[model samples]
Target: MEKRVAIIGAGTSGLLACKYTLEKGFNPIVFEAEEGVGGLWRHTIEFTKLQTTISTYQFSDFSWHSFAKEESPNSQQMLHYLNSYAQHFSLFPYIKFNSKVMEVEYVGESSEEMEIWELWGGNGRPFFSKGTWHIAVQDTKNFSRESLIKLVQQQTWRPNLNRRMMALRCKSTRRHLETGVHQREVYEAEFVILCIGKYSGVPNIPLFPPGQGPEVFKGKVLHSMNYSALDNKIAAELIKDKRVTVIGSQKSAIDIATECAHANGVKYPCTMIQRSAHWFFPELNILGIDIEYFYANRFAELLVHKPGESFLLSLVATLLSPLRWGLAKVAESYLRWRLPMKKYGLVPSYSILQGISSCRIGVLAENFYDKLKEGSILIKKSQSFGFCKEGLLINGEAKPLETDIVILATGYKGDEKLQSIFKSHVFQKYIIGSKSSSVPLYRQIIHPRIPQLAIIGYAESLSNLYSSEMRCQWLAHFLDGNIELPTITEMEKDVKVWDDNMKLHAGEYYWKSCIANCGIWYNDQLCKDIGCNHRRKKGLFAELFEPYGPKDYVGLSHKR
Candidate 1:
C-alpha cells in the first residue's frame, strides 16, 4: 500500500504506466481531467485517420488486427482500441475520470525510519501528505464540452495550489465552469508518473509581425487543437462563400485543407499556405512491405549509427553514403512521378532522409492530387505572415489576401505545460535547461535530479505507443528496485552524448534528438538494460535484412 503512485493522464502512456505498475505490484491511481479515456484521439475530429498504419500504432501486448478493419484506422476506431485496451486490462476501475490535477508539489523526501506528513492549505479540503508525497487535483462536479475546453486551456498558473486558486479564477474562465463548490482533493502517494503526452494543450500560434493590433483581422481564427468543436454546420457557415486559408503544410494543415475542400466543394476554394516543402509518404507499404521495414529496422540503423565520439560508426555511414543517398533519391523521384508536387511548387530542396530525420514527414492524403487538379484545393507558398486590415500579409506582399477564416495548424507547445507544473528551481536547472526541448532524461524516463518521478512520451519514436510501452516497462522495473540508475554525473553524461549525436546529425533542435530517427540504437540500449532479447529475427539473412516490427517485441518483457 505504501507503494502508491499517481499517474497524471489516462492517455496511451498513462494507461500503459498503470498496466506496468500493476505488473510490478504497485498501486496506481490514474487521474484524467476528462470524463473518458482516449486523450487527443477522443477530442480529434471524427474524420481524422492515423498518421501511421494500425500495425505501427499498436501496443506490444495488444493487437489491432482483430478490431481495426482499415489499414489505418480512423479516430473513432482509435478511440475504440484505447477503450478496449483499458477494459481488457481491467484498468477502468483504477482510473478517476473528471479529476484534474491542479498542482503537484514535492513536499519533502522520505526515510524508511520516520513518519512524515506535509500540509498545504488553499483551495478546498486542506491537503495533507500522509505518504511520502501528495498531488492536488481539481474536483469536477460535472462533465461538459465547455468544461473540457477550459480544462484543456488551463488558466490556473501557479504550481502551488494554496497560493493561486481565486486569482486563477479571476484571470481565466475556469471559475465559470465550477459549480460554486471549490473543492480540491490531494492524493498521498510515493511516486508521481507524469504521462501527459504532447497533444492536449493550448495551440502554438506565432505572433504576427509588428503593428498587428488585437482587432487586426475580421476573420474567425482558430487552432487545430479545437478542430473537433467546429461542427459541420458551423464549418459550412464559416466557409460559406469565403476564402478559407489554412496556415501550415504539416499533417493537420493538410487534413484541414482537404476537409474544407470537401466541405465547401467548389464554393469556398480552400487554399493551403505552405511555408516550406515537406516530404509526404505517398504509400504506406513500399514494394508491398511496411515502410518501417525499409528504414526503421535494425539493419537500417546499423548503416547510419553514430556511436558518440566513435569514428567507426561515422566511417560506416561515410562509406555507405552513396547507397543512402541513392535510396532517398529514388524515393523522391518516385514521389515526383506519383504526384504533381513540382507543378504545385511543393517539391522539397533536401533529401527525403534528411527531412525524415528532421521530423517533417506526413502521410499523403487520398485523392489529394485529384482534388488539387480539380481546383477545389489550391497551394500557396509564403515564408512569413503579417496582419493587414483585410487579412494576412504574406511574405511582405503589398496586398493582403482576403480570407474569412484562418486555421492555424501549428503544433502544440509540448514541454511548456510540463515545465509550468514544476518549480523554477526544478524546471530550469534540471528538467529543461535554458529554453531547450531536451528533457535530459536518462533513457528518456527517469530524471537524475527529480527523484521518484518518471516522465514518459516526451521522446519520439517511429511509433510513440511502442516507445512508451518500453519506457513504462523500464520505469516499473526501476521503481520496484529490480534495476538501479547510475550516478547523476553518469546520467548527465549519457544525455549529453545523445544531444551531441543528434546535433551532429540533425542540427541543434531538441526534437531532432528523438529516438524515432535512431529507433534500433535506442531500443537496443533499453533491451540491454531490461534483460530482453532485442534481436527479433534468427537466421543470418533474417537478422540482417528482415524488417522488425511490433510482433517481434510482443512478450519481450517476459523474456527478462
Candidate 2:
C-alpha cells in the first residue's frame, strides 16, 4: 500500500507539508482545528495579528500580495490573501477542518508486544509545533521499549525507519457542540494537520496579579485581540479624552498607542506601562514580506529593520536579552551617529535587549515619542507593583488615571497543553527514555530510537522568515526518506553533550530549569546529523554554528 502520511497544523508548515507530501506520492491528510487556514497570518489585522515582517512570511514558491508595497499587512487583508492562496493552490480540499485529534497511538499491529515496540520507537505519534515542546519519558512501562522494538521489526513502518507519529485533528469551537459550523458537521479523518496557529484558543489577557492579579481592573479590561475595529472609533473615544495607560509596551502597545497618537492628529501622551526598556529597529523584511506589507496599509513605524542584516539577527538579540542592554546602548549610540534620521514618527521603543521584541506583545513604544507629543498617551515605564480600583500602581506609587477600557496587550504562554497529554508516569518515562535534557527527540525533529515519529516546528528562530516554511521542508526532507536521522546512541549523546555544555557555561549547579528547546540548538543538531559528507549537504556555516557564543549570535545566519 502507498504510504499514508499525516500533516498536523494547516498553518505555515502544515500547508507546506501538504504540498510536499502530495508531490512525493504520500496520501497526505491535513487537519486544522480552526475555522480556516493561514495560521497566525490569519489574523494580521490592526486589532488581532502577529507582528512578524512580511517579506519572508511564506515559502519560495509563494509570496504575499500585501508585501508588494506595504511594510506590514493588517489582519483582514492577510485572512483574504491566505484564503486566496489556498484556492489558488487547491489545498483546501485535502483539509479536514474543525476536527480535533483527541488521542493517537500506534495502531493496526496485531501483537501487543509489537504494539509496545512501535510505541517506543522514534517518530512516535503526535507531531508537535514550533515553540511547543515536551520532555521525554524516563521509564519503560509507559512506552514499553521491548514491545516497540518488536513492532518495528514486525510492522511495515515508514520507509525512513522512524516510527513516531504526528497525531492530532482539527476541532470546532466548544460552543459549537451545542450547534455546528454550517454543514461541515466536523468529520474526523485518518490523518491530521494542525495549523491551529501558534497562538492557541482565545488570546488570553493575563491578569497582572494572581488573586491580586489586576484584581482592580475596573476600567473594562480587554485584550489587544478584542480592540475596536474602526481606527477612528478607538481614536475618537481614547484621544485626549482620558489619561490612557496601555500596559506591556510590545508591538500591540506600539500599534494602539501610535494609532491613538496619530489619529489625534497631534501629540498624544499616554503612560506606557512595562517593566524594562525595549530595543527598536526598522522593518526591512520578515518571512519574505517587506515592511511595505504594513506601511502601505497606513501603519506608521512599518519599516522595522536595520540596513544590513537578515531577520534572524533580531531573534538572537531577543534570545540573548540577558546580555543585550549594555551591548545595545553601544550599538544605538553608534547607529544614531551613523544613520541618524532627520525625523521619525516613533522612537523610544519597548523592545528590550537587541531590538526584536519578546513574544510580540502590545509593544509599540517606538511610536510613543511621536504619538506622545500629542499629549494623549503617557509613557509609564515603571513596573506595576500592584493594582487598585482607581488605576495601576507603579513602584508603589498609586497613579489613578481616567480610563475607559483596559486592553491587555500581554501575549501567550509557551504551549504546555501538549505536554499534559502525556504528563502521567507512564507517558513521561516512555518518551524520556535515557535522555539527559528530558526531551529525547533527535535533531529536534524525530526520536532516534523510534524512527517513524517526527516533530517539526518546535524551534524558535531569530529570523521569523521561512522558519515555519523551511521547517516543513526540512520535515519533508526527512519524511521523503532523503535525509539522515541520528542513531539512538547519537541522540542520547547530543542530549548529554548539551547538558554538559549547559553545566560548563552556566556553572554545574545553575538552574537550567526554565530552558525550553530553541532553534539554535536544533539547527546545530541538524548539521551534526548530516552524513560525514562535509562536501555534500553539510556546508561550512551549518558546521560553524556548533560553537557559536551569545555575542556571536549576531552571526545567526545558517545554510541547509
Candidate 3:
C-alpha cells in the first residue's frame, strides 16, 4: 500500500485515478500543472456550455448533481461541479497543485515483484488535502458488455491526455529530479497510474494560407476557445450592421455561424461556407427518426436491441455520418411527419454534445443553420480560404462583404505539446496496443518494459469514459498482480492488429490517437480477456448509462 502512484493532471481522469487508487489501497500522488484541478474542462475548452451526447456518458452512480443554470451547464457550471466532486470526495489532500512532474524514468530492472517509479515535482504549492476524491464503485450484476459499460460511465468528464504526454519534455523544467527517462529523486513504487489527459492538446486545425489567415482578418479571427465577451459584444454590434461568415466544418465553425445568424437577424447577411452538407438536429439527436416522438417510444426500441455484434456490429446498423447526412437531406425535402413541427432538428451548434456524462463538453451544440434558414435566421454559404482587407475571400473569387467583427471559431491543437514523441523513431516503430502504450507501454495502459508503471487516459478511439475508467480498473488489477500482462510477443501481436484496424476504419492520423473514451479502438478485447472484472461485471452502475433513459435519445437522437 505504500507503493507511490503518480498522476500528472488534476483534471477529471486525474481525480478519478485518485479515487480508484485509494479504494484499491495504493498511494496515489497526483501532480497537476494547473494551479487548480479540472484540466482543460477547467482551463481552456472553447465553448462554456459544452454538453455530451454519449448515452452512457456519465458515471454509473453519480446523479446529475449540478443544476447547470441554463438547459445545460456552462463552463463555470462544469467547473463548479468538478470542484464540488473534488471537495465532497475529499480529493484535495492527495494533489500537488502548481507542481509539474517534469519527467519519468524506467530505471533498472527490479528483482522484487514490484516496479519502481522515480517520482519528483516542484517544491511549489502545498497539497490542499491528502486524498483527492477517493470513492469506491461496486457493480455486481448484469450480463451484457453494455451493462458493464453503464457501471463505468458514472465518472463523466475525462480529458484526452495522449498528446500532452510530450509535456514530459516539451515543457521541461529543472528543480527536483530530471533526466531523459531516468529522472532523479527516483521514488520506486509497485504501481504507477498515469492520469495525464489527452484531448485539449489534440486539435486538428486544418491549416490554410498562413499569413493571409487570421492575421489577415481586419477585425478578429481568434480560436474558438479564446473567443469570449469582447468577441460576443462586437458580434452583437456587427449583427446590427454588417455581413458575417463562419468557416470550418467542425463543431466550432458551426457554433459561431449559428450564433451570428441568430444574433444578426435581418441586418447582417450571414454566410456559412460548408464544404459539404450536414444533417441538423436538436440539442439531442436522433439519426433517422422524426424529432418529436423519436425520443419517446420509437427510439427506445432501437437502444434496447441488444449488442449488434462485439459492440462493433452496431457500426453496420448505425451507418456512418457520410451515409447518414445524405439520407437526412432526402427526408427533410420529402418526408412530412404528422407531429407538430417547431423548427425540428435545429438546435444550437453548441448542442452537438455526444460525450459521456463523466467528461461532458463545456458548451451546447444545437442546430442553428435550419433556424436561420427559416427567415428569423440569416445564413448562406461561401467557403473562403482567408480574408482580404476589404472583407473575407471566398474560394478564389474575391468576394468582399464588409463592416465590423469576425469570430474565427477556429479550434485548438492538443497534440502540439507532444510534437517530440511523434518525431521519435521509437514512437513510430512500436506505436500499437492503443492502450496508452506509446512509451514502451502496451495498449496505452501499461509499459511492458516497465511492468508496474501504468497510465489511464490514452485509448484514443470511439468510447472515452468507458475506456478511461476501464484502464484505471485494469491498472489497479495489473499493479495488484491480480491479472497478467500480454507476453511481449502477444503484446506485439495485439499492437499489429490495432495498428491495422485503426488504419482500416479510422485513418493514418489515428496512429497517434486522442479518443480516450472507447477502449475498443485498440485492445478492448484484451482487457476483456484478462478479466478486468469491472468491464465484465453487470454491476449497478450500468443502469444509469442507458441512452434511452434520457428523453429524445431514442433513435430520436444519437442516444447510443
Instruction: Please list the Cα RMSD from the true structure of every candidate, rounded to 1 decimal place.
Output: 7.3, 13.3, 13.1
The CA lDDT of each predicted structure is 0.69, 0.43, 0.44
lDDT top scorer: 1
Candidate 3 lDDT over 1-560, as tens digits, reads 23456666777678767766676666566666445677766543333354443333334334344534344556666667677767777677776554444334433333232212221111111121121111111211212344323432211222322232322311222233433332233233334455666544334444667666556657755444434323345435645545666555445566666666566665665565555333333444344443322222222222221211345545543544444344434434432232112243322222111221112222234545354555434433444466667566666564565635555554444333332222233323333323432333456565443344455665443334444555565555444545545455555565554444333333322335433223332233434534532122144443223222221111111111
Q: After superposition, how far is residue 430 of candidate 2 from its true place, in Å?
A: 8.2
Evaluated against the true structure, the overall lDDT of model 1 is 0.69
The positional error of residue 471 in candidate 3, measured at the CA in angstroms, is: 2.1
Quote the lDDT for 250 in model 1: 81
Model 3 per-residue lDDT at 527: 44
